[model samples]
Target: MSAFDEFAAVHETHIGVVFLVGERAYKLKKPVNLEFVDFSTPQRRLAACRREVELNRRLSPDVYLGVSEVSDVDGGPADYLVVMRRMPEDRRLSTLVKEGEDVSEVVDRLARMIAAFHSTAARGEEISAEGGRDAIRQRWCDSFDQVRQVGVLDGDLTAEIERLTLDFLAGREPMFRRRIAAGRVLDGHGDLLTDDVFCLDDGPRVLDCLEFDDRLRWLDGLDDIAFLAMDLERLGATESARRLLDRYAEFAADPAPASLRHHYIAYRAFVRAKVACLRATQGDAASRRTAREYADLALRHLRAGRPRLIMVGGLPGTGKSTVAGLVADELGAVLLSTDRLRKELAGRSPRESAAAEYQRGIYAPEHTERTYGELLRRASELLAEGETVVLDASWIRADDRTEAERTAARAHSEVVALRCVAPAEVAAQRMRERHGDVSDADPRIAAAMSRDVDSWPSASDIDTSGTPARSLAQALRVLVD
Candidate 1:
């Protein structure tokens, strides 16, 4: 019998028959044709099998044995297959995530592993500006076309999605080009979905990189990160997704790459939703039902609008910052404080600046301008990505409130201007007892507070003269309800 029949005699699947020969397992790719990928010729299949083995060795050195020719008949080579050290099937991330395993640790481990992998991977020196843009654009177009072919999407929903996609693309293309010009694109494992990750006892391993096409593998690091993040979110691991991103940014040690994070995330979400919708129409009955569920989830998240932006506006010592933190924690939002921004900009602690009388620089017109600008920028960006943002600032100026309102309006998001007010005596007493507070505004500043400050927005207002926890409970009711 031929070697193919011999392998088939051992295994069940005729296409890509997997068998154990000695200590290693051989995976042979059948000469099959797929819509996106093709292995039509024996030589082509052999080359792909060899590429998989070679590329996988970079990450899973112990698992990828090598590639070898497997002749159909004795002494006559007809095809080839990849040989690998068989791993415990349960070690796959998909299986672990399904079992409600400790995915946080697994994802965190993946972040570090991917970081190391990207740092060492080769980057294309000849990546053209237009070439990168076209590649991204083409991916989106092809994905949309696939969805169109499925024919399950309604006309109105498809049109709305198309509009949103075009809007984001138009605005983000310039930024993407700038990032590409700065060499943010590098050789990476293009397909980093959960199924491709293996959680071993030692750590996590990423395999099955895009070895055939360098163009697909060569991309902005954010794209790879987004793929993983999107997978985590889809698997109902939002917290794990957040932790993975946090760990990645911490280990990467550079915030420059973070600017592109939101854009990549949105793109990833869009593509994933599209694919899910397409599969709903094309898959088998059971799979199509599951795909419909995924599509509904995606649509809900897409239409949920940006995360709520809460601006805590009040005079000094009204417990604005404390209450803001509580609300942020409860809402799973980012807490942006003017006090922290001030300290970061001045290179001095709030107390030190207060003692030196040089702290006025933190609230100076120019510095305050910078702080508010950064806060609004971050808030809008996060909100657009469906993340809540809590802005803790005095918001003592009418112009500041107006600017924030305009930002929310432009982003099609909601803003809750929370006004924390307290009696003058109460404010002073709390500020005087505050020892480690980060705000430069002193208790004495409470006495100097005038009544001519900007008017609070007509939105919700909370009186913070009572216990902070109580005040936060009230705010939470308004936010969550």
Candidate 2:
């Protein structure tokens, strides 16, 4: 413990030890097995220390001094270490964000820096296989499984995250295949968060590339930047995060969808959440709170990705509104129901029943069109403010769905339609059980609507005749997938 008086400050991680001396820093690999990496022997530690110095020099060239030895004065080999010139703590990217300094210019520069690195990063068959479609899926499953099996977070939250992630991986097969085929995967800094960066006067020097395992650093370039963006947002620099993405896209001429950005951000957020929970298990009380906070942040990222418009529709009494409400709560979305909006438009309460016959009186053809138009109008407004919206109605007409698509296009958002269906008997039973809810559709009305509600192959289908839990799960899969 009394190694040197020049460096009294020291920090120990699971696999490495760092000592901050005057104007210098020394890092030593722990003689232990981390399951991910092993430094249990002198020769292994020497190799790892050399690798750390070499990998980190790519980003922090000036900071990494060289390798050193922990041998006795008698020329006996004891251990190995990586040496570095210490950087000013105040110049760290995280410190600047904490001080509320304007770092927009540097943040932009950081994006370009990463873009250049990713453009020239090594990519071969072996590297691609490490980040291949199946490997990436397993990586996600393994990460969430770590958190899931440990029972660190809430059970409901764990279940929700698992369902959403599983759906994204299962349904977005083409997205992953295209990226892999395009050679978007590369060896990158596995941990590129803000804290690992220094905003020097020359530029930004990113430090601490994942040195434990080379496979861990093999990644999709977008995923690499995503971890940084997520960290920037976590530090309350949301505008900086947005700027980084915008600048990176311009620099790289990327054509990936807005959905992919959201996907990566959500994935990064969850990864950080898992990290925080792991820290809590190591007996960090503050980290326990941070774990929950990160979990919520991940949910938000998963919810609204570029202001999508989700259309939930079917014949009346098929549980469209019920399922829509469940989705809204899951995504923290703005749900617009025709039954509620129609009453509001008529200067009546949402709970009030308008005893009009099907396709007659206030329920006439023109009224239906106007009601849908207003719903679309409101959805556009919310989307403009960066809000996801759910439209609940019996969209039995082909023109109705087309109109919704047009509205989403004009608002620069994508449309996902979820068509609910149930047997005639189940539909009639649900209608009979309804009392003071918003919708006023009766069993007879449902029969009338079902006659016209032809199948639309474009929309995802959700059979709602099962238990509510099963129906809600199906609805979530449709929305995410």
Candidate 3:
């Protein structure tokens, strides 16, 4: 075919081989015995090949065509193969995230798809029992043991991770029990990193559902998505990950606790490190370095970083939220939007029309004061818990900026103010072009804010009239460093 053999390319994963022949691909299960799975025999590998097509079809129905038996060994009925269509490399979600393509819309659709998948996924006594408190603890503890036995990670870091995981799981037994009783456990897509997902025009086609072991596939739906979430965090797509979790929780009506989120993120990071170590043992040089990197990521997840308060402020349409979103994602900090908070507080739809004049109606000074106070309250709470936070608001008044500084002082955190500035003409144009935004700043309000804007000499000013990506990179250099 095309001056070559039928198979044009070969790929090797930890437990499988893939042969890419033109637009079609065939996967062959590796005959090996790992700690979590056994595919040592041809019969077992064949069954796993069938299971791979069967389980992954639930997520990527169009991509996973079917199973095939291909004979390339000793001219006999030999190795089993999974035949499917191959997508372009650029369409992968991981690639899009790395390339900084705007995939916010795709992430929304992804959350919906995952939520729907979990709703229809299998859940019963058998599955729920496997997702019980003890079972979940055992799974994390086993991960710790495995990573430790691998002898690749730092000893003190491992001890600290084990300590944190054990303490969190032990303290949250009741929550796990409640989740199990609620029948929220399911046979989910167990390995949900970005590499296995494709963001096609239709939507995301998720593949690789960890089919070798059924026990590994059974999990709490939250735990299932956390793998992708953790991967997103590591990829510096933190805001997208946050939005995905929030949308999924809102859609599923199954909000996970902050502690549970931390636990699972650490677990997923450790698991990533373990997988990288496996690749390293097989003489993959890049994976050898990646193993340590993932281990360091796990260590960061297991421990709390120094708390800081990031202030993103600007007149309307200077792209405060855009820069703050990037800063929050890079730091994995909590993002609080004043516009969303105001809409929430006013008990009004974000799209509802508001014809308020300057400091009139719900935009009155009293309401403004209350919103700022509540925002600071929330920031203080998160900071007190040793989590960094980013507040997206217009710090027009010097008094309000002082209040934020005082709040950070009380919480024992430093305040970093990033004032986004665009020329008056640019800001005016942006306001006129704004659509479908949560912010209620019309051109009139933006003009009013611009006229009344006060200068903050101490604040670092970032010109945001240029390209958003380059502007954000500049802001991150200041905010993160």
Candidate 4:
């Protein structure tokens, strides 16, 4: 009764209740202990409130005021509250996004602000461990088990998502170590939803970081930022989400692989799906639909993050390297050339010529097999690590092509085969004019190899007789198709 009636509205969450009054908000931790959070005692709740104020001030200094306590008539402490200066509800980013407002500039500024915050965030061994593969896998397992216990989502969909997530994490130990060494892991905003961001005229104020658990707050900066990105995509602001990530990458100088970004975003989506499922268990019918949507979004991101193995093959002087380069640039793929790999295996520089007859020298059948074997071996490792690979080689032999396909299958990846071809005169002239090139093949070698080449029925033929632009366009079309 003590100023309880003064609150215009009261919002209750699973772990806390917020009282919204004139120009102020008060948060009271609920007396509950869940599997993830524990605020069952007054002392613990007060400690949490103080921690929230101390941490949130790092971002929204002017918003979090302090902690206050209410007293009973008998002069005993009744309850504690986290007092905050209420932000403008109408200026919330989620509201603006739902109203169809253009928030490009807002997102840009937000990304920069987040990057700066992360630049000065706390980092050390403890924080870095949360970004490692084992920690990530454990958190994923926790979410999966929680969602399964709720039994709100279809078991099969949940199982598939879990499989994809675990498989992706299995081979990322090295990448995770690289991230830790590069100082990409830190204590970041754990719950960066659009609903908690206020876009004021001065700047954007982010609120409601998960202060209850240090483990939740300590994570890779990319995973922290992906929380908001995932929410923005959920709100149908796909372009704005992309803009935010691009700006963050530019501002933070983060060179994270695209697959890792997608994976983290997917993980965040699944976490939200778990929460939605919990809400559905509490009898929120609408949340059931939202849970499915989030789960499906997670699945979609998982599929997008899967690695690809693209084989660009053709006889020498068919412009295969050119096409492969273009494709790699377009797809952000790692390009590996048999021409370079072969020379490397033979202890020769790429430009060092090893001219020999067909099936002789470095081009010998035995040597060629070794080169292709090494190529596929390297590609397999890369694919396991969630990288798209473009192999620039003459995959004219059926055995090597089959081996590449098997490698991709082992990695749970996709294989794309492209065969480049040019007119006889064009190819001959290209081989004749070749200089400082890694390939040792001449027009004579090419003609002999052409006669001996096996039929390639599965590869998409890309004619390189036209302009390079035309050839690239054709190859891209084939790739997308």
Candidate 5:
């Protein structure tokens, strides 16, 4: 069952082998049933070849020629092959990136092309189900089991990554539902590695999608794009990887949070790591190292995407609320203010006048404890579901700060304590000028609070005596550094 006497080159992967002859490439499915794919029979292989061509033509129409039947000497069909126009070996996106080429324009065009493709890709109830939180959790659990079974990666690290990934998914059910409602789930190119993308003179030709499993192909658009973004970062093109996501978000008008982007990227990396583990099991020694590298990348992205509890506290009129709002905007975190939560918990409006002396009436020790307790309770719930939170309150008591720390610890989150400060006169003036705000503190109350304020050595002091922008900058630096 041979047409060509000699092949120019042969490239072999776990699933199939490609024979390059002249200007055409022929792909033959290996007669083996793997965990993720099946090509163990002639009939199945033929169907797979046909599916590959039909699905791939959506992106690379000119390159995918058609499925060909390889016959025996009796002219009876013996095997099947995916025949196509061979792309230039030197023109792959991976090759160009390795050569340090300035591929900014090419990356931009590719992002737009993928965005346009996703804009029209299939989307319905069935496909949207694949983008749900449960679907994502299943895939992650599958990868974890496979990786653990292989016994190649470090067990402790694997567990940590697994916990972080699940925690991220736990808090994002609403976000995932929003994506489904907005039609972000689609049947897309599931295998979007850079090596499969050919950067040609005309534009780019993206090929070699996961054709064996339709379930795998049905995913959120962000998950589809993340495969390539993960590959790009692995290739050391971190900036290009970032730009691609940014441009794609702009083109698609995707209102995804940064945490979601990082989470998806981490998921892609873990999937590749799973593949590498499989390769290692097949006796590919170098794949073992690759598996570790991918696992590490996955861990890095997960940590970057983990939820945080940012505590912005100081005496009243030191601009704690203002700084907390800015930090929340910067990190896309939920902002919780004592003033707002206290009012909501009680039977009062946020702007209703509740002017009272410090630690009295609505601001009593018992009532204040309830407000902070409620804030921590709400924050713990959000953090459990992978949401970052910034709490704005006068953290004058060490007991309250300790409680916040304990809450963060329970959620496996980092706590950033920021103590906002201003000149005494500035604070007094701000309190004096307070009008329709939720805060009931006046200059006299501010002075009383300052005297009662406990020592807070752990928190970074953000001086609010200057402009709001300056205070925000200081707080952000503390968060970053």
Candidate 6:
């Protein structure tokens, strides 16, 4: 008997038929109708099924057995199924989260795995600016349509949401356009949720990528990160979201895109809520209730405004990034650093941009003006959208710190200046030992630093020369208070 003939068959409401072979499992796409996806034809479904197998191999090579054609005696294709090495049914991340299991090890491992995957995935052919804008607009339209079909939402509430969606998209159009122009879109796993992740003795195995269309899988990396973060929040694991993000940043060769985390997180939440509402409209009573709960959870996070803006100012190697990252993690805010921004603006890595001429370009009076201006602009936008922004920079100039304060005031938020102070000799020593850092400041730059550097902001000051955890704890308390 063939493997399919001997195995027990199962059915999945959303996808298709599944069969459990002795040591392997097979999933076959079913002919179905839904608003966002369709697998109605054998040829179309088989192609997508094959793509799924290939895409999933990027992250879970051990589990994706391969794709095989079901044949009727003569070895010609009859139907198709994706074969996978079987995993324990209870090993899903969603199950672990629900059971209140210790998942820190698993979560951290998966974060590093995803970071590696993003680094290797092929970049899509550059999209036209107009095309990018139209795609985003269509996403909003689909969201509205999905919400309306549920028929459970109040008319006034629906209209209010629709208005907010439009206004938010309109406000962020420029930044969206910039990302598209910069070629930030790459092939990514489309359906990234806890259910699709399985934990193994070695590490996490991610499976079931959206493979029907390249367009769905190809998107900005920020969008991909946001999906996982939003899902974590919906599952009531806010702290896990922070840890995952921090791990991603630490492992990635390139830093996380500056100040874009808040916007992407909100956008992902909106998408998740809309999809859940759409499913609730067509699902059974039990499933409908579950979907409503997910939608409601996402909405709650979206309405929670950004955390307050806090800047860590000092000379090079003064522990600014370390303290800022810790505070941002504790407060569940995005950490935006000048070091990352300077390199991104120059379109090169820190090492490449560190040439003498480039160094002058980076710190020139005009360049400094532009850099700080962009940082404040991004910080204000994220805060207004309901996210806390942590600005990390060597605010060696009184004028630059003043501009940041002004920006916070205009956003109807206060700025908490975290001044990191250390002995000049100690700062120089630390800078000398640094290597492969994205920050432009080096040991030679520190030698020129004067004790007459700018006056400290009339805010909190922490001496990072001692234990950093203690300093960070104090800063976090101020943020929470």
Which model scores highest in TM-score? 4
- Looking at model 3, which ten-residue stretch has the lowest summed lDDT? 165-174
Q: Higher-lDDT candidate among 4 and 5? A: 4
lDDT of 1 at 137: 71
Ranking by lDDT: 4, 5, 2, 3, 6, 1
Error in Å for residue 327 of model 1:
5.1
lDDT string for model 4 (327-407, tens) is: 899889999999999999999999999998788888889999999999999998788667899999999899999999999
Q: TM-score of model 2 relative to the true fold?
A: 0.66
Model 6 stretches with alpha carbons more than 4 Å out: 1-9, 32-40, 73-77, 126-134, 156-164, 181-183, 253-259, 287-292, 305-481
* lDDT minimum window of 10 residues, candidate 4: 1-10
Per-residue lDDT tens digits for candidate 5, residues 235-296, read: 99999999999999999998676788899999999998998998999999999999999999
What TM-score, computed on C-alpha atoms, does each candidate reach? 0.70, 0.66, 0.61, 0.88, 0.82, 0.62
For all candidates in order, the CA lDDT equals 0.69, 0.82, 0.81, 0.91, 0.90, 0.70
Clashes of 3: 0
Native-vs-model 2 lDDT?
0.82
Candidate 1 per-residue C-alpha lDDT over 308-360 given as tens digits, one digit per residue, 9 for 90 to 100: 66888788888888888898787667889988877777787655654323225
The CA lDDT at 226 in model 3 is 82
Off by over 4 Å in 4: 1-7, 342-356, 360-381, 402-412, 421-440, 454-481
lDDT of 6 by residue, 310-381 (tens): 888777888888888888887767788877777677677756545343337676667767888889888988
Off by over 4 Å in 3: 1-7, 71-76, 280-288, 304-481
lDDT-wise, the better of 5 and 6 is 5
True-vs-predicted CA distance for residue 10, candidate 2, Å: 2.0
Global fold similarity of model 1 (TM-score): 0.70
